[model samples]
Target: MNKKRLSEVIPLWKADKRNYVKKSTFSTYVLLVENHLLPYFGENYDVQEMDVQNFVLEKLENGLSQKTVKDILIVLKMILKFGAKNKWITYESFDIQYPTSRKSHQIEVLSRTHQKKVMSYIQEHFTFRNLGVYICLCSGMRIGEICALTWEDIDTDNGIINIRKTIQRIYVIEDGERKTELLIDTPKTKNSIREIPMSRDLLRMLKPFKKIVNPAFYVLTNDSKPTEPRTYRSYYKNLMRFLEIPDIKFHGLRHSFATRCIESKCDYKTVSVLLGHSNISTTLNLYVHPNLEQKKKAIDQMFKALK
Candidate 1:
């Protein structure tokens, strides 16, 4: 082996990685390396399985989500593998263990009444920003996607909202100086680039504006400059507070939309496609819990069939 510390090998690995991934993806990898990996293992040449397991435990104890810690491990493994391939360090595979938690994560969503109330309020007093929230409720578009949407992407004639791009602020480290930049990029996954038909009401609301709005302007701002997700999130939070609605994360809008669709007995595959999920299983997992009534009805139906 060339006997180089991990810090020495990281730059080489990053330079090679930059060519293969999207800018947003590369930024995410850089963050994982700088914030989680470097301080713990920067000077080390060889990281053992025990070291990684302990790191997983430490990160969990420090309140990182299991998913987040797993993401960090993936980045670490990739960097290590790259270093080993370059003969800069010896690579050993790591098998890390996580303590299984008994608690199930509950997805937050607005109650049907609250959803209607919010929608009604937005309809009664419409602004471009409020319109974004209404559109998310109707179409299940993510905040980033909605923020990046331009008037040109909305097909008023066809009553479809074309989802093509997403915007977020990403942290970047260049020449050892850390800074943030607003990045407008393609949706995270290819499946996320899709077309969602607008609700008839939504189409009617949008038609008049579409005729007058600048095609290049962002839908949320109705201007050339786009608002990034963070700022949009703050506006959403304040709107909820002002309306005396319980605060759920902004993503709850998307979840609320999906929940409504499932409740309406929309097919799982169609819901998944409309929500831009990579697969139907994701939609089912998120929104398909059976209530006690549903469970009892299913059992009754099964008994009747047997009889």
Candidate 2:
């Protein structure tokens, strides 16, 4: 792409500070240059105002979402600023704004009866993966954190479990079906790296499970390697189907946990901590929170006392 007409300074400048960036950031920068920037303006291309306008229009029409277009434009602006500073090109003000973002979607929470029925189904039928489902129901652990759980993190004597990491997998569409790739990652947020106290029942259930051999991780295969996220998801889905449960995203269990917490008068701060939320605001804003029934009950109690 060093073939276009305007200036050769960009590649040189990019190569110069390659050492300053961290590996992941540098990799992303390389990808941006190779995959996005270069194709539009090979080396030696002059970017006139009209050319910039035309490119912006093309970007919008190309099915890039507004957020993505905004990001691309930000990258462009940085490159142009770099070019101007190094004396490669003259500058004009470029306005970069985005179309409004999509509104937040509503969260779905299972009603108490459905939650009880699902638990009963799992308990009576599927014994092995029940811990996986139960933790999501009780603590709202992300599937990744649930999958990453290890025997070492379980403090059976103290009735607490340390959440240290998570397993994440991304699926890229290769042919028609998606191909999966796995990566072990830090908990989604720093707050997610936390400790959850086990209920007495949970502690009792896990006692015999602790005798299982684990060379390193808590949840492992026969060979002691980690459980793959996709595999866990498949197992979870199949278990739900076998139980004859209505199909809800596995994440709904987390919502049910949080909702039940509120209904039980578990304080928001405690619920926030239990859920490993980075901030209480995230817990309040995202969780399908208290509804009118809870509020009406409190008002009714106050009036009954007045009589």
Candidate 3:
């Protein structure tokens, strides 16, 4: 039996894995290995379960979230399996445990009054850049999706916006110097490629400009050049500050849209589809949070049913 060090086998495994996954995914795996896994396990070909458990604990203690640690572990497992398949190493699966009680964090969303105030402000004092935020509030589009949208993606006749691509600046290491590149690609998931119908108000606001704007120009920039997510996020932050609105992450616009739909008694399946969530459970877990009134209503219904 031949044994190879993890450091020696990982490069070969990465070369083989590169052809199978998306460039972004491949980059993520490379990053995880280089940043987390290889540094710890590079010398060991036959990694022990206890070693991995300790790694997880140490990472958590260092302030890495459970999801981030899990992602690192996924890349680690993949490399281990690759080495095993080629007889460079042997494999053993390990079960990991985490704290049963997790800190519950509520999703932040704008209040209805604040939402209305922002919408009204945008309607009265509108710009092509501000329109992206308006659309996110109404349609639940992500920052990347809004940044990538072209005028052609909006069909006024159909009143739907086709979500096809997303723009992100990705990290890369070139010649041992780190640089970033702008990548315009399909969205993060297949489900993210979807069409959302525009609200009547949104459609009305967009109609006059659509006639004069170039079809290929990005919506946010209203020019051939595109605005990236980081820039747009800063723009939103400044806008909120200028308006004296409470600060929230750019993603909260998406959360606000989904929460409004759920609050209005929109069905779970439709809300899930509109938000481009991969599955209904994600929609339920995030947006189906029952308020006090809802819990009280449920109890009242149960008592009435007994009568």
Candidate 4:
């Protein structure tokens, strides 16, 4: 039997896998292999469970999130399985355990006053570009989805915004060359392709211009050329600073929208569908956190029922 290095088998596996997955997915696998797997295990054809377990610990120590490390391991396992199937190496199944995480990520949201302030300010002083931020606040559109939207996707008559595509800049490495390119593709999942009703305020703001702007022009730029996510994010940062609002990620707008919906007692399934999450559990887990008031109310209701 011919001995095969892990490095030698990776390219072959990538070539096979490339045809079967989305470009974004393939790019992620390649990135994980080059940055994580190759550096750690490329020279070793005799990969073992202990080596992988140690790699997981090392990655955790290096400050990579558990999810990210698991993603890397998934790619590594795929390559190993491919090599094993072809008789290039032996494959061993392994389980990776993470220490109990003490700190949970807090979902950042705008205070109701802050949210109202932003909406009022934008309405009083509006720009075509500034409207994107308002849309995100009113509807839970993601940065990429909002950036990709063209005027044609907006239906003034029905007051709906069709979320059909998303724009992102993806890292590509080919023939030993690295480059980043803009990719306009369908949203992250089939669930993400959805329609959101425009608020009355949004419709009023957008209606007049909708008659004048070319349908093919992007909503963000009102031109054929669309602003990318990075540029839009910078614009959002400026808006936040100008409004004297505390610093939060652009994604926080989406979180604020979803949190507001859950607070208003919108059904979880409807919130999930509106947010384009693939499942209701994700919406519940992220935004349905109960306050002390709600917990106490629940306890009171239980006592009343018992009586």
lDDT of 4 by residue, 1-307 (tens): 6769999999899989999988888888898888999999999977888898899999999999999998998898899999999989888898777888999779889999999999999999888788999999999999999999999999999999999999999889999898998999999999999999999999999999899999999999999999999999999999999999999899999999998888888989999999999998888889988889999999999999999
TM-score of 4: 0.97
TM-score list, all predictions: 0.97, 0.67, 0.97, 0.97
Single out the weakest 10-residue window by summed lDDT for candidate 3: 170-179
- Which runs in model 3 stand beyond 4 Å of their true positions? none
lDDT order of candidates, top first: 1, 4, 3, 2
Give the best candidate by lDDT.
Answer: 1
Error of 2 at 71 (Å): 7.0
Q: Per-residue lDDT for 1-307 in model 1, tens only? A: 5689999999999999999999999999999999999999999988888889899999999999999999999999999998888888888897777899899879999999999999999999999999999999999999999999999999999999999999999999988899999999999799999999999999999999999999999999999999999999999999999999999999999999999999999989999999989988889899999999999999999999999
Give the count of colliding residue pairs in each prediction.
Answer: 0, 11, 0, 0
* Candidate 2 Cα deviation (angstroms), residue 255: 2.2
Candidate 3 residue pairs that clash:
none
Superposed Cα deviation of residue 82, candidate 3 (Å): 0.9
lDDT of 2 by residue, 183-219 (tens): 6667876788999888776778777777775636445
Question: Which residue runs does candidate 2 get wrong by more than 4 Å?
Answer: 1-104, 170-181, 215-217, 220-223, 288-290, 293-307
